[model samples]
Target chain A: MSFELFSNLVGAFFTLCIFSFLYKDNPFYQAAEQMLVGISLGYGLVYTYNRVFVPYVYQTIIIQHQFVLIIPAIMGMLYLLRFSRKLGWLSRYPIAFSMMGVGMGVPMGIHAAILVQMRQAMVPIESFNLFLIFIGTIAVLLYFFFSKAHKGVYGKFVNVGKWYMMIGFGASFGLTVMARISLLIGRIQFLVNDVIGILK
Target chain B: MKKTIPLLIVIVGGLIWVVWAFSPHYVLQEVFYNQFYLPWAYASASFAMLLGVLSLTMMHSNKIKMRAPKWQYSYFFFASFVITCLAGFIGGIQKGGLFMWMFENVQMPMSATMFSLLAFYMASAAYKAFRARSPEATVLLIAAIVVMLAQVPLGVKLSKHLPTISQWILDVPNLASKRGIMLGVGLGSVATSLKILLGIERSYLGGD
Candidate 1:
């Protein structure tokens, strides 16, 4: 057989091996899982080294003669120091710096997620649908307000918030189911079209 | 000294990022982050993956040393890892290469199979948990059914209005609550980031 055909058959076998888990866990599924973990890790390491480490550090520092990049180069080495029992504390420096980058980036996320969302919530309320949306948003936000006791007039609004949140969660769950089903359909398509050649 | 030094680094590094974000100066925005911070971050991230690989290797090695159950399977992991690394490094990732061939034949199918298995779990979950136990549950069940049915071709055949009602439900009530929760989470993240920057939360430093 041609290499392409052989590869497709192997892929089909592996797919069936994993699907065997639906019946119950077996050696076939276990072997497939282990091979996947090892191969994925290997792929990640080589990809990172080739794409990121080479271009950024090797080329920039050595060839370009940018000695300044050595600072982060040292920091990156220090990250590996975590493997050492005694010198593990040194890893915290790089971790802290990376966390700082992550922390500082949060403001941009807040701008997009919160500020923009709040802005979008400000509808003209010309229609009943718009008004209901406006009220639903406010009520839900109030539900998350932990300081106030849920009683009296405020409690009624909180109840409305609870209902809205439930409906929202239900919709999300439905979407999730659809997404999973789509994945199943994709696998079935592969099995039928590629493996069995039942479909063109 | 260890904890104190890391905290200082966090504060200084965080301040630079904040300054870079808020400041519109060409140097801060363009030169500082793009030139300096980004390369360092990328280098750090690349090296960080080594830590994960090392941890995995040590775990499996120790498992083999102890003669743990399924110790033979660890050999599969080690051999696969070595073979893949050799293929990738020697062959390169170009089209029709061994690396690409292995990835297509092995990794892709396995990942899809694993993800697809979630469909069975979700179906079982929906069967059990989707009952109309209360007023809220009833609303949730009805909304879920409407949304699910609207997605399939059979639903359109059942009723043209199913899709419209599902869209309305999503566009109005769902968006409102989703926005509300997201706003809260965004604000909370900003607050936590500030706490971390200020050195109030030192858990990242590992221990007391």
Candidate 2:
């Protein structure tokens, strides 16, 4: 069969197989799930090898052929020792290194990007609709504040916060609904366009 | 003598890398990124992948040895895993080969299948969850129905006004709510990262 015909046939079959899961769990869904996991893993491994290891290692060791590459390469090899119970302790060296690296990187990375950005977002700007901005900002901030008791003078502010929070949640719920609706429309379109070819 | 020294090195090295990242000097940044960061990420990820594969192998091997009832399925899984790995290893040399074929044909279809299943699952879940039993649920059900109807061309043909309402619901209120959620999420993430950085959340290190 032609590639187009083959693709159309396979697409239709997959669409049905996926929909079949609604009735009950079956071998088809299981097969599809397992195949997906395997393929994704396989692809990820290949991509990583090409993109990361080759450049980093080959440049240092083979091309530039620096002696320093040997240290990291050996450290990397120690990771394989994890499979052996006796040598598993060696694996911890690489693991510890990775954990420390990530732990250290995250905070430093977030310092400017997250903290600075958040502070900027909170800082109100002058606008003609200052009342709305003021109300929204103060109410949102009040919604988060929990150190002191929210009563009397603070109670009114807390109530305003409650209203803003509710509106925020309501709006979020509405967006989620719309997103799901869009997804549903896309599937229906697929069924119409690909399966029946009516749209075509 | 053996483990303690390595652990200390890791800790000290990690602190140095963090400090270097925030440093104003270009030399420190170059050393961290080129010499340390990229290599470390790759090496760690590779090891993690290897560990995952090993666990998969061990699990299936045990199932086979014990003659489990679903051993046949495990065998299928193992066979597929080995075949795919071999294909990848071989096909990596050639740009478009058996590995690429399997990925595009077998893998892509399966992923699409899994994704499409979400539609049916959502429908059933919505049927159960979106009951208009209370004032809140009623509002939810109404919003869902309106959104769902407005998405389809049929809704547009039925009433031109609905699309505008849907757009408003999505743009104004939805955008505001999303921003609020994002702000909360951002704060939570910052807190968690700080905790991890300070060694307060040492659970990630595999225990106390």
Candidate 3:
């Protein structure tokens, strides 16, 4: 058989091995899972080394002779010292560096996630549906606000919030189930089309 | 000294970015990011993955040394790692090479199948857990049923309006609640970030 055919057969076999977990955990499932972990890590490492390390560090510094690049290079190296029990404290520098950068990007997050969403929620009340959405959004927000005692008029709004939240959760769960089913469909397609050649 | 120094680094590092954010000048925004921050972040992220790789190696090696249960399977991990790395290094990562071949034949199928198994587990969960015991449970059940049925062609055939109702349910109350939750989460994260920068949150310094 050609390499492509052989590879497709192997792929289908492993795919079945993984699906065997629905029956019960077995040696085939364990082997496939272990191989997955190893392969994923190996693939990630090679891509990072080739794409990031080689281009950014090796090419920029060694080939191009940008001596200033040594600063971050040393900092990155320091991150590996976390494995050393004695020098693990040094890794916090790089950790802090990355965290601070992420922290400073919060304004952008607020702009996109909060301001934009709030803007979208502020629809013109031309339709009763728009008005319902407006109330639903406020009620849901009030549901999360735990400072006030949930009684009287406030309690009624909070109760409405609960319904909205439940519907939201239901919608999300439905989407998740659809996604899972699609993934199963994809695997079945592979089995039939590629492995058995039935579809062809 | 350790805690103090890291906190100082966090403050100083944060201040640099905040400064960059406010700095509207071309040189400050473009030149600074390209010259300094971008390279540092890239190197830091790559090293971060190396830390993960190191931790996994250490954990597996220790397990192997003690001959833990399923220790033989650890060999599978090591063997696959070696084979994959060898393939990538020796033959390159593009098509027709061993690396891409192994990825297509082994890694992609395994991950896809593993994720697809969730469909079975979720189906089982829905069977056992989706009982209507209360008004709230009944509401959730009906909404879930409507959405689920709407996804299939047979459901649409059964009732022409099923898809339209599902779309309305998702687009209205569902979206409103999601936006509310998103706002809360966004504000909470921003607050925590500010606390971190201000040294009020020192959990990242390691100790409880």
Question: lDDT score, residue A194, model 1?
Answer: 80
Tens digit of per-residue lDDT, candidate 3, span A1-200: 87668888899989999988888889998988999999999999899989998888888889999778777778888888887778888888888777877556677768877899999998788898788889999998998899998999999988998999888888888889889899999999999888789324
Q: Pick by lDDT: which candidate is best? A: 1
- After best superposition, candidate 1 residue B171: deviation in angstroms? 0.6
Question: Candidate 2: where are CA atoms >4 Å away?
Answer: A7-15, A81-86, A101-200, B1-14, B67-69, B93-96, B132-172
Tens digits of per-residue lDDT for model 1, B52-158: 89989998999899999988888889998999999999999886898988898899989988998998998888778877778998888888888989999998999
Clashing pairs in 1: none
Cα DockQ of the candidate 3 complex: 0.75
Error of 1 at A53 (Å): 0.8
DockQ of candidate 2 (2 decimals) = 0.32
Fnat per predicted structure, each in turn: 0.74, 0.24, 0.70
For each prediction, how big is the interface RMSD? 1.4, 4.1, 1.3
* Model 3: residues with Cα > 4 Å off, grouped in runs: A198-200
Task: Please tell me which model should have the higher lDDT, number 2 or number 3.
Answer: 3
Q: Quote fnat for model 1.
A: 0.74
Sort by DockQ, top down from the best: 3, 1, 2
